[model samples]
Target: MGIDTFKEKCGYEIDEMWLPRVTAITSILNKPNLYRYFADSPNYPAAQRRLDSAAEWGTLTHEVVERMLKGEIVKPDAKIIPSIKAFQKWRENNIMRISDPEKDVERLVVDTKHMFAGTLDVVAEVNGTRGVIDLKTSTGIWEEHYLQTAAYLSAYNKTARLKEKCTTRWILRIDQYEECLGCKAKRRGKEGVLRVTGGKRICNHQWSEKKGVVEFKELEGYKEDIKAFLAAKELWEWYNKKFIRRIPNYAKN
Candidate 1:
């Protein structure tokens, strides 16, 4: 489903251009849960709390980093200090210059060609290359994330109305690292030593400010995936109409 927003001051609504978000179509929640190797011992309440923490950490980290990229120094909150520190450490080692960011490319102008819309996180030059950059805080870079980036790249290229085509798009991960107690027997000992892992980290969540740890990757197969994303959108539309969200007046106008 797509989210609808109206600007009170503008007086005119931008609704006809409404389309499902590139993110919703490529939603991580829709993916098949890959079974964790050593996570069969599930703590339901603890798991829920950790999930909540991850989501919170991700949002706070995004706010802090966005300000930092604009050359603003923000005092990190206790919750997201590790994540901000991790990104800062990476920037120190890497070359980055923010040209522009927080771009919204979801316009109705292309709804006829592409039936999707999305907001971009950033557009900047990193290590000499300039392209759209998306901040991700998920467990690991999933396939859906790749497609989501590709979709945003397509939308940005069109919305910006640039002469030269924008070729590259990136997904920058700003996630916290935590100690994993799952694989204690083999690596650590019978005494159970904790391993620093990205996804399985449970208690005392800390971001490792290791070089290249919190990093960016070119969105590979971006062009090819746009075709896949369009197909998925068509299917999503068909499903929604056939089962739910079929009311005409209540639907997006």
Candidate 2:
């Protein structure tokens, strides 16, 4: 897709909240010579194909972002053009700016060994304090979104070269564009809300690092739930690397 098309249609910007997982997964999946480990597995070919597709998608997405930020207009390929147009209309109506678009930032850091690391999309000063901002394209918000943001914060605390602490993290939801015809109703609707199809709110979140907490104002038990999620992610990673890697020929069954 064209970068301008994606940015204008999506109507949101990337943030630090997405860095941790993206960084971690990208690092693991893109690790130098790491695919060799899967060479003997039955799923190697399919896995490699999937990985290749993912890499292409990642590269395309990055290119789109760069083009958009540079104020260049991009033309999407035929397959994605219709959707892109629809998204453009939706974003034009509901686009919300979470921070100043004019800021100089550094690149994101991704680390694999620590089971956490990734580059954040945007890090800027919010009200005189540094904060992380993430952009997401989804039909609706998921609970894990908060955990993902928190994980990014944790990673930033560990590896960001900046001397200042990232005291805030945010998730900005860019609703998918929905198009319908033959009715008096609006032809296009919000993407994020369209996913829920209910009265649920789809907006942005600001997580405070100093408080040592992340909050989802819409959900009552958000804080406790996030803590549990982080713990589970840690355990799952450990099991996959330390335990699952040791299993022999179990996949052949």
Candidate 3:
């Protein structure tokens, strides 16, 4: 997870692409706080806990989806069962075929040209259109997601040579209402449900849109997006001193 590991695996030291994590760059740049559902609450700790819980659930969702896509049996907990089922239903309904569900599916890639590294979620084709797709449990897709995807695509293109390189890109978002924090937040306002249990507020929530899949083609100007993402990478490096050379005293004359 550190630069040393990257160096050992990538067979290189920190050059142009030291270890500038792609997600970190997009997050540091102008990424919006999509988890601002409880910003207005006086109980900041509870709000933070809520955010933490959602993040943990998101990770679980990713695991479930990954297992299912790889043709592995999944036995998710009771809480995340609904979201898992929803994703299963979507994949079944959409007739998704596992394009490349290999162990290297989610790979940590270093784009030496661009000076960034990140693990891409999925590289596969859905419904016969080949592309790089990222799974999301978030409420909605954001510009930052595209920026992140652009970085992944850049790395994929540079490292791996495929018979037919993926020119199509997509953000496949699968989520259920009960697992969504924002949806639960709305229940307190719209439904006036103040029901509390086991030191937690339980409200009647329902899914608005169970599943959403967006196809982002290279024709959508991914070349331009890559340029912008690299610019942000430079900004992040300069600000964080990632590109600075300290000149170790032992090496220095």
Candidate 4:
């Protein structure tokens, strides 16, 4: 989304007031890796296009997986079939259950005291541990992802009943890539852009079958993460104070 659109959608309407979004708040932090990515790119416009396309692709994948989790049979796009298959395999292999599909899947949560809101991916139990499961289609999980999930978990627990409170948070990354047979370099082809990572620069370059990778990682230290998130929220508000001031229903606190 563009800057203006993002600013407008940074919050959710509640009782005629707008509460800031968790993701939007966390987005204020600096990312050195992202800066390097842009610096290494041939040009800013091309890099932006690739990033936009990848975001769309990721959203499509999220929608398909969410629908499937809701017990709706879904045929994912041909490009994302591998990732979906990996997710299905993981689901079958693990003792995981979506507590309440209707309410737990893409659950909308709000922290009234903090005045923030977000739609979390899943409220689930994996291997007997109940927690928030955040789905990601990024190449790698970053610290900001932990902050995002931490914010969701905190907000969710605030309003949840005793038994419904989450004990922890997790990031479930679903991605597909092809590895070179000779050099073992992995190539990710998302949104029609092929990017290679690791291995020798010059090689015979025989690529293996495209395979999906699912990584489930538990994020710790929610106490600190949420603190960081709130700090970021403060910074975000300061950066957008002018625009935010124009929002009629926005709660500046």
Best by TM-score: 4
TM-score of each: 0.69, 0.43, 0.72, 0.93
lDDT of 4 by residue, 72-101 (tens): 999888989999999999888899888789
Per-candidate clash tally: 0, 9, 1, 0
The runs of at least 3 residues in candidate 4 whose Cα sits more than 4 Å from the true structure, single-residue gaps closed, are 1-7
Tens-digit lDDT track of model 3 for 48-122: 766666677678778877877788897887666656776666666775555557844676666756556788888
Q: Sort the candidates on TM-score, descending order.
A: 4, 3, 1, 2
What is each predicted model's overall lDDT from 0 to 1?
A: 0.57, 0.42, 0.61, 0.87
lDDT tens readout by residue for model 2, 1-253:
4534422332223232211243332222223344532552357765576456434543444444434444559875443344344435533554333343433222354333344344566555544556565544333355565555555565565655566557667654332223222221221122111111222243332221111111212223445644655565555445444433433311210
The 10-residue segment with the lowest total lDDT in model 2? 207-216
Q: Stretches of candidate 3 above 4 Å error?
A: 1-17, 34-38, 178-219, 242-253
Off by over 4 Å in 1: 1-15, 28-30, 34-48, 101-112, 163-165, 178-212, 242-253
Q: Which candidate do you rate higher for TM-score, 2 or 4?
A: 4
lDDT of predicted model 3? 0.61
What is candidate 3's TM-score against the reference?
A: 0.72
- Model 1: lDDT equals 0.57
C-alpha positional error of residue 7 in candidate 1 after TM-score superposition, expressed in Å: 16
Lowest summed lDDT across 10 adjacent residues in model 1 is found at 184-193
1 or 2: which has the higher lDDT?
A: 1
